[model samples]
Target chain A: MTEAVAIENLSVTFTGGSKPVRAVDGVSLSLGQGEVLALLGESGSGKSVTLRSLLRLHPPKRSRMTGSIRVAGRDVLELSPGELADFRGGVVSMIFQEPMLALDPVYTVGAQITEAIRRHEKISAADARKRALALFERVRIPSPDRRLDAYPHEMSGGMRQRAMIALALACRPSVLLADEPTTALDATVQIQILLLLRELQRELGLSIIFVTHDIGVAVEIADRIAVMYAGRVVESGSVRDVIRGPRHPYTRGLLASRVERAQKGDRLETIPGSPPDLTALPPGCAFAPRCSLAAPQCREIVPPLAEVGPAHTAACIRVAETV
Target chain B: MIIGEPAHLPDGPDRGGPAQPLLSVRDLVKHFPVKGKGLFGKGAVVRAVDGVSFDIRKGETLGVVGESGCGKSTTARLLMHLIKADSGEMVFDGEKVGADLDLTAYRRQVQMVFQDSYASLNPRLTIEESIAYGPQVHGVSAAKARAKAHDLLARVGLEPGRFAGRYPHELSGGQRQRINIARALALEPRLVILDEAVSALDKSVEAQVLNLLQDLKDEFGLTYVFISHDLNVVKFIVDRVMVMYLGKVAEIGEGPAVFGAPRHPYTAALLASMPKMDPDARSAEAPLTGDPPNPINPPSGCRFHTRCALAEPVCSVQEPPLAAMEGLQEAACLMALPGSGHSRAPAPVEAAA
Candidate 1:
């Protein structure tokens, strides 16, 4: 099976601050066709930055990026301006946390979707409109015709999100990049979106990179989970292995701290201390201070991504077994 | 104030009783006028809290869960008297709050902790000053209030020697929230309305804060009106859960009952939609879809009928009352109401299908 997306030792640093902030340290990830990979992290964990880098959506002047990103057999980092434009929506599309901001407020949803279709393909306005309607129907938007005429503000949060998904799917991209698409939605509405995405991915065979802060959301959607802490991928494994038995201390701490795991009246086991500042990370493990089983050597040497089980890798020194 | 009766009554016992709840809200309604559009013609009414009613039993946390614009926050504001209700009755400890009611005394007994500690705390005030300010305003001596503030600071796990003199901005999100909790407790409030108090924190920090909240509740015997959008957090903290949709109660039951076997379709959908951390527990289907209807021109009969998967014709024409369920629970759904006639309908289809 062909790998739909491959990221090799990717790193991103922002130079605008007084001290250059290493937002994303060396990280590598890959997803096969029709696979869903969830990049899980909290605020400032660089999950969003990694996702945006697939389309090179960062400012070029103030920030520096290293390593290679290949999506759909194309070297994303080496694309020309025109090629990059063609690759963005035509090859890989993205939905965002806030649809209101992503959607153009002044235009009707129909015009926006049709415009995206026309920009990438040689199609008449009427044909684009027809395609837009079909896309809306595909995303299961109710009252598709009326919703097409609605503005971003006129539609509710869930409707706007569906419209955003419809817009992203207008180009029929091979890989769908969703950045917390359901974060702003209600639980009932969010599940609807999640299920829709999973169904669409299956039908269309589109690889997906979903970024979110919630572990539960990742477990619900992802085929593989990559737990990001600070700037790096601390743990990468199948969802069952990661959730059932996380090898990394950070992943374990996150699971233990989940409210669902704790019974009533029991104190939640927490990883003490805050996330490290990106501008000046510690010499060794960024999470060592909070890790319960951190050895003295963990402070002097950064642990590599060592395999702990079949198809499982954890960046922790405590793991003793390998596949 | 009634002239024939005494002006004051002794405070009721601090625990649950069959006769009365610590706080009783009946038919609470609040409407905010939509601006500018009204200048041209008739203004729209944002029905924030539309005839919502519930009771907070002593020492029990009553959670209000909902989406944005669902009136959960508005209900908290109404209880705090920060905003006056258009119409309703709030009876606290057998005394109905009215114009003649002692507002100061009522406020002292019922306090609120807000979500944004940054906005709630005065930037200029030190941690100790902010905590002590409430008691000082309530006629406690300055020195005694300061001593109480120090004690509370210690109780919240913030070392007063280091934190009491620091400003709010200097503290982390978790520490600031602890101070907020301590300040609410300083008033010796019997009821604490925590509105999304820990929603902004990270998951680990949220867990720590939740544990602290449980500890404080036990120590202070505080009855909390915990309003949050995060159902998982609500499940862990609150004793009774009240699921709200479009400014109305969809279901009210004990935590496990509401989460496990929800009676209302909306409640069931919300519970089913929750993303379980365990991969093996993947949801079979999306139970329901669509955004809640506009609150200004909410759907008739049942506000949730517009998006409900089990909605029947009667649900669009006749509203369902809060009918009793199997346990000490109630749900406002035509399917759950015995005489609604839709109770015998075929199984509802999944929205995702």
Candidate 2:
């Protein structure tokens, strides 16, 4: 399989503040065509920052970014303004958590989708509108003709999300960047959306980077999962390995903290400390303060993400000692 | 009249009486008027909570699970009397709640904790003062209230010395939530309404707060109306569950039974929709099809027919009453009832290893 997206030594630092905050540390990731990778983390973990960097969504004046990003065999950072605009929706598209906010309320859903298609390809208005209708039907919107004229406010949350996905797919991008697309939706609607995404990915063979804080959501969607903490990828592996038999203490702590794993009336095992401040991180592993298996060596030297098992890597020195 | 839990109702032979429920809501309804299109035009009504009813047993946690605009929060607000119900009866400890009800006595017995930690508490008031303020208004002396607040703060695991004097802005989300819990319990309420109380906290912090709530319930003999969209949390903490769909009760039963063998299509769909924690277990198909019909003009009869996969022609025209299923489970669906030709055998609860 060809590599759809590859990132090497990516770092993002906000220099506008008095103390420069490094949001994304030296992180590296790669996703093959048609593969879904879930960047899982809590707030301030840089999972979102890492995904946003692919599109260069940060303000260049306030943020200093150092990275080599290759998507669809093109270097992302080296793209000119015109090329970047073409690359965004033509080669890659994004969907957000709140589709209503992402969608323009003033215009009809069809108008926005047609505009996206027209922006990427030189087409007549009628042709663009026809393509937009096809995309809407492809995303399973009922009464495609009627829905094309409905504004964002007129549609329900689930319908609005479907419209967003249709808009994202309007340009037929190979890579999709979804940042918590289902986070704000209800559970039933979330499942519907997740299923729709999985179907679209398989049918279209699109490489997707799904960012979420919910581990269960990650398990449902991703083939491989990358656990982020304090701007670093602490663990990277297949979803089954990362969830059932996690080698990293942080990953283990996260799985153990779930209420489903514990019996009623039992005290849930917690990580025992707050997430580290990215601006004032500790010397070694940022998770060391909360890891129950942390030792003197863990606090002194940073543990590189090393292979613990076949196709699984964990950034913990004590991975061997764990079962 | 109290809609008694007939299926799960405890024996009444000993005292010649089944103990009255801690709180009972009968056909409660509340609607807000939408803004008119023109100055002289009449406003439309949004049926936020339409004829909802339930009962909370003493010392029991009744979990209310629903999607957005499903009236879970509105039910909580109604229980706290934060908003007046347009029509229906509420009985608290056998006393009717109404305009003539003693407001102070009612406030002393029921308290609520909101979801947003940063917005819920007063920024100007210190943690201790905020917790003490509720009790002070209910006739407790300021000094006594402060002392009680300090003791309560320690009970919720916040150190009085470290947290009591700090303002709301100084504390983290988890700490502020703990303070909120302390404030809710300051009046020693019998029933505490928690509306998405732990939804804002991180997983670890949420676990800690949930455990704390469990311990506090046992110690204080308190009942909780736990309202949240998270099914997993509700399954872990609540003994019984009530599933609401578009301001109507879809199903209600013991947690294990309700989750294990959901009778209502909506309940089953909700259970199937939860992203399974185990990656190996993936749902075969989308259980539900569409968004819930707009509540402003909800579906003619059954509000869930628009989304339910098993919805028949009759489902959209005739409303199904909440009928008994298996054991203590009750579901409002014609498909699950006998003589509907769709009555399937109930799925048994999986035995834990």
lDDT of 1 by residue, B190-291 (tens): 899999999888787888888888888889778899998888889888899998887888899898888878888888777777887668878868877567
Measured by TM-score, how close is model 2 to the native structure? 0.93
- Residue B310 of model 1 has an lDDT of 71
Per-residue lDDT tens digits of candidate 2, residues B1-353? Answer: 12221211232211212377877899999998878673324676778899988888877899999889888998899888899999999887777776434666666678899999889999999999999887666666788888998999999999999888999998778889999999999878778999999998878689889988998999987889999999999988888999998888999999889988888888888888899887889765778778766667788767887876667777778787777765798888877655543435233334311
* Per-model lDDT: 0.87, 0.87
Native A-B contact fraction in model 1:
0.75
Q: Which whole-number lDDT from 0 to 100 does residue B185 have in model 1?
A: 87
**Over all chains combined, what TM-score does candidate 1 have?**
0.92
lDDT of 2 at A123: 99
Shares of reference contacts reproduced by the candidates, in order, are 0.75, 0.70
Question: Model 2: which residue pairs collide?
Answer: none
